[model samples]
Target: MASKVMMTPGEILREGELEKRSDSLLQLWKKKRGVLTDDRLRLFSGTSERAKELRFHSILKVDCVEHTRKYVYFTIVTTDYKEIDFRCTEESCWNAFITLALIEYQNRRAVEGFRRHRFQRVASEEQQEEPGEQRALSPW
Candidate 1:
């Protein structure tokens, strides 16, 4: 069984700063469906075959319970899954499916990028200020 962390929208909104490789998903959520942008408009499919093989465990099994106008819930039984949404299905199933897994992955990636940019900006400023060997490490 995979461990899951259920966070409310309020909790996600309260993050003040992003850590290295952290959650910048909130920024990415400027799209229509929050973080998971409509790939149809982006002219891309939501899921890729490699993403499925890499994300899903060998023993993983998914069954879609409902696909309504609002949201779709998929009951996924897996061995070890990091908190993510919308993974590709196995044989006999076509196209990507909606699951929490894909949302999590996109969120993580977006956050990580934001953090990396933040660090880069900080490091650049430090480099501009320091003129000697002290440039190697700036406590600030």
Candidate 2:
């Protein structure tokens, strides 16, 4: 069984400021407060409310675009096929944080799925072995 900390969702893993590339035509760089949780990565502006959310369930993968002297660039690819670009200082390691969190989320999901499947199989087997139930004999 997985530990409580690894299995639990909604736990805050990392939080910091990151610069994201805008999705509009101008495609300018905008600052965002990024929060990496066990299940999702949320981006917020100066306001208290979240501006954008990329849930782990909807995220396909995170890829490194490039790494420069000052910044490490990366992209978050969503399940819907949308690409979101971001960059942060090399020391900050925003990209690494997100990638690790995403991997952990995926692992948790896989563990849950395996557990559910195993439980269902066990329950089905138990039903077949119910008390007072008898197996049919061969005609031969």
Candidate 3:
């Protein structure tokens, strides 16, 4: 588990309850608040214990986002198909925050993967070249 103090570097975009449908059987909604941060989304129950942590790297996509008169609703779908629902006051716009963070995370991952692949290809090519065949600086 990541320390909350260390999590400070991550911005907290929103803090509010995990919303439930009127017919849902789960009774714990009142105690759990969805916390949106730059690196992860967390569900915190009561205070000290973290119910769940969904890291940006593990997120496959945000399945849905909906709004009603009273609140904004969104669902985060993880790589493993775990769906987490959250809602906040209409003014918070938590859905946008989560979407932006996920986008940024995905972009960064893509760039890093590209860099690693390029480096490996260059290194392998250099190894395959004969010592005297290496390109030399132009004297002219």
Candidate 4:
């Protein structure tokens, strides 16, 4: 059994078996089951030493979330144009959790970007003006 590793910082929004579709010519349509985390999706073939990690930022989108009688299926499309399919039991709702986590991650990044831009702008404005001509800070 592979001992679990501690999560670095981000809260794990979801974790479970996400069977990844193999892209090798030999495996063709073969699926490899592995553990999925909010920050990265990893697959290990019988040993933790062989784990493969796919980070969330590298993922372009989660598409084709559908379900059959047995399982819910979805595809993760990476920025590099790689498509990895995953299937989980219907009750797991892996698709919904991944979508929500991706959205939240994007929102956090946008807010941080805006804050950085605003800080730079304010600093530049202050630098351009003389100390005596500095504008009063707004109460808001």
Candidates' lDDT values, in order? 0.37, 0.89, 0.72, 0.71
Clash list (residue pairs), candidate 2: none
**Lowest-sum lDDT 10-residue window in model 3:** 20-29
Measured against the true structure, the TM-scores of the candidates, in listed sequence, are 0.30, 0.85, 0.71, 0.72
In what order do the candidates fall by TM-score, top score first? Answer: 2, 4, 3, 1
Q: Which runs in model 2 stand beyond 4 Å of their true positions?
A: 1-8, 131-133, 136-140
| Candidate 2 overall lDDT versus native | 0.89
What tens-digit string does per-residue lDDT give for candidate 4 at 9-92?
Answer: 555556556565566676344344455555666666644457677787898888967789888888988999988887777887
lDDT, candidate 2, at 95: 91
Candidate 3 yields a Cα-based lDDT of: 0.72
Candidate 1 lDDT over 1-140, as tens digits, reads 99866655323211111111113565231111122222211111233222212232222445565555544434444457432233222431212332334445456667999999999999998897777557567565
Clashing pairs in 1: 24-111, 84-100, 84-101, 85-99, 85-100, 85-101, 85-102, 86-99, 86-102
Q: Enumerate residue pairs that collide in model 4.
A: none
Q: Candidate 1: how large is its RMSD?
A: 18.2
Error of 4 at 79 (Å): 1.8
For candidate 2, report its TM-score: 0.85
